[model samples]
Target: MAEEGVMAHIPINHPARPVYRVLAGLIGLYIVVFGVFGLVETAGDDFFSRGSHWVLGLRTNMAFALVSVIFGLVVLFGAVHRGNLGHLMNLTAGVVFLVVGLAMLTVLQTEANILNFSVSTVIVSMLFGLVLLATGLYDKVGPPEHAETEREMRSSSSARPGR
Candidate 1:
């Protein structure tokens, strides 16, 4: 008997697998880079009050940087591991980002924004969220025709009688 290959078991029926991987990787990388830049720029200031860091042309603080880095890492992890779990992660992350961005838009310059919120940040976050959300829902768009063909092939082969 032939040894089953890894690809043989991994289901790739989803049309959005490639999209998810790319989105995750890009989003994760951008966040991580933003976090690193933020930390470096404010190295000498008080962690809580240091708001001189610039992320994507918008001002941000150390705390926000930390959150961005952590979130980015999670996204990167999901991107590297594609499957049902990864899709779920992407969906969850997208929702969270969208909510956070929308919430922040209401308190752009208020004291509530201890981490330096801005319109740019909100827009970028929402865009990323949309991308993630779309990619996550790719598999749900429709049933894959290939899966049906595969099933028919299996059933036909199993029904053949030859000793």
Candidate 2:
């Protein structure tokens, strides 16, 4: 009984396994939504020459929106599945975002960027990237072994109920 139930409840894997996946999924969803909003706001404009516009309060362009959609898809897929693949995807995306954000700083005054990133956009991107990167790199919590010992102890106690 009680001992058996306790042993059965011991998870085979780490308890923190779902944290990364859920975080990735959330990040992906946000990106997808903002991207779609950007696309809709800038619709009917020349894709290449589309002027910068703020969507969801973030400045962006059509190309950036498309890229965001693609990034979201990959991240979302990784989040939906469990394994090293998802972590890798999130790690890669985070790095890319970090690089893009840093690069945007150099061209803050210029108009050469297709993304038309602003100060807020750069800050947000870098922060988000850092979070994803750190979460992806975090080691999973190993299987709980102490539970087994507790179960055994409980079993021995339950077997002799004279006291």
Candidate 3:
């Protein structure tokens, strides 16, 4: 019952699912490109240096660039895959991006900022997080019959008085 309740809340076979998936993929591609540029720009710099290197309008260092490339690849994998794997990856990536953005924002003025994230980077991360979260919420996949059943259940549940 609990699982059914949870499933009922998520949209299956949504019309905009493909768009969301493509958007996620695009975000991933952007991140990958940024990371690559960052790596090139930060070459010969210290791994965690608070240098003046910027990539795609965001500050970066060798360490952060490497992390970005790896993380972006993971996101790309999630976007490319089908079914619950993509859903789970997107949800996890969204939470990670949001957390990283907040954490970077807090340390923007301190030496603890290992990634050398600028304000713009933080903003972009938060925006990407929101988009990924929204995509995940409505990215469920299921057969037409299941979608129909889910729709009926949702309608019936909404029609009933407070139960």
Candidate 4:
């Protein structure tokens, strides 16, 4: 019997799966929060006058926040599902975070209020960028075999129909 309780996760899944998953989740959550914050600020009377004006007004930032939240959620689901789509989504998310972070860092720094931000926010944001970049350089874990199409798996697994 394969056991009726918690089944073992074999070695055929992504090895660095947890790493990417956690990173993606964190990134996604951050993005969601960031986006919400932006929306709130935008709706306020003094949003335009404080913080890095570029981040506050740029379309790219809006896109990044939305994608970040989405990627995080996808990665979280992938962690649970353990499939290719999840990892791919995470990879895309990481790439987006990395690219946006690098691009925006300069813009943020150039802003008049960059130096005025609470020290922790700046540090955390920088770390977030690095984590995303690292997550993008993913590693393959376990057997290369993974969730395949029904037709693909059928031809591949049908050799031993009674096994």
Candidate 5:
């Protein structure tokens, strides 16, 4: 089935899973630091002001900085937690970053751009989203038996013609 192929493509018990997890955690740490700097730079500013304040080479305001701090903390927690929690968090964060980037791009020159996003910020967000997505896709965990089955399925599928 198409769903089976989709689900089966995700590697289970990957050897590099820990590396990806650490990368995700590092991204979370970077976000937290950026947010902290943003908050400091935007102190006393209006929450949603479209001012030219910048942090870590990205435009930010009080509201965006606050949200970033919270989001980064949650991501950090997910990265530290064992099991599927990190997978889910990475997937969710990837989607959120992409959506926010697109949304901000659409309103870059409009008055509705509450996040104070710039082109560089959008690019960074999209890059982060893609990295997180890749990490999530390759970070699945499973028992030994499940991993063996997955390997077998992949081998069989690859051996088939026109598959």
Candidate 6:
């Protein structure tokens, strides 16, 4: 049998507002990075210097990046207003971005023989996803002072009861 690993808390209840604010800012930065990268890719064929176009083309990547930026904006708003649902929406977007990032990596791996992604690019994407996941998990817990936020989220949920 394998040993179990302890689950880590997201520190949502650290009694400090700065952490959340910092997280929002960081997420926003990540969103901008993606958006900029996508736009650049679209604007030029050799954006990555890999000499090969992304599977969906630079335009498609730009769209995905732009969506990610929008999601980040929502997250920032949530952090500022302390809205639980807004944070959840951000988490959802982050999750989507993570999945897409993974898919992008897999695609790159398949096309490695033709073109390769830089080590930094892979590391950055993976790290970004991990960050988003950690933050989302923390938001889900809503520990300590965030109980109200959590409750508001439950009450406002669109899901039917007893599903």
What TM-score would you give candidate 3 relative to the actual structure? Answer: 0.92
RMSD of each: 9.3, 9.7, 1.9, 11.6, 2.0, 11.2
TM-score of each: 0.74, 0.72, 0.92, 0.46, 0.92, 0.50
Question: What is the C-alpha lDDT profile of model 5 across 1-163, one tens digit per residue?
Answer: 2346676678888988888889889989989998999999999999998999988889999998988899999878877766887887887888888898898799999989888889998998998888888878878877888888878889998999999
Clashing pairs in 5: none
Q: Tell me the tens digit of each residue's lDDT in model 3 across 9-102.
A: 7888888999999999999999999999989999999999998998888999999999999999999998888898898899889999999999
RMSD of 5: 2.0
Higher-TM-score candidate among 4 and 5?
Answer: 5
In candidate 5, clashing pairs total 0
Clashing pairs in 2: none
Using lDDT, rank the candidates from best to worst. Answer: 3, 5, 1, 2, 6, 4
lDDT of 1 at 107: 80
Residues 3-122, model 2: lDDT tens digits: 375334433334465776688789889889988988887777666443768887788778878888888787788677666566567668789879988998888778676577789888
Model 1 lDDT tens row, 50-163: 365675676778777777789989988866665667767777888988999988898887878877778889998899898877665652222467556655766798899971
lDDT of 4: 0.48
**Which candidate should be chosen as best, given lDDT against the real structure?**
3
Return the lDDT, model 4, position 148.
33
- Cα displacement (angstroms), candidate 4, residue 9, comes to 22
Clash count, candidate 1: 0
Worst 10 residues of 5 by lDDT: 1-10
> Clashes in candidate 6: how many?
0
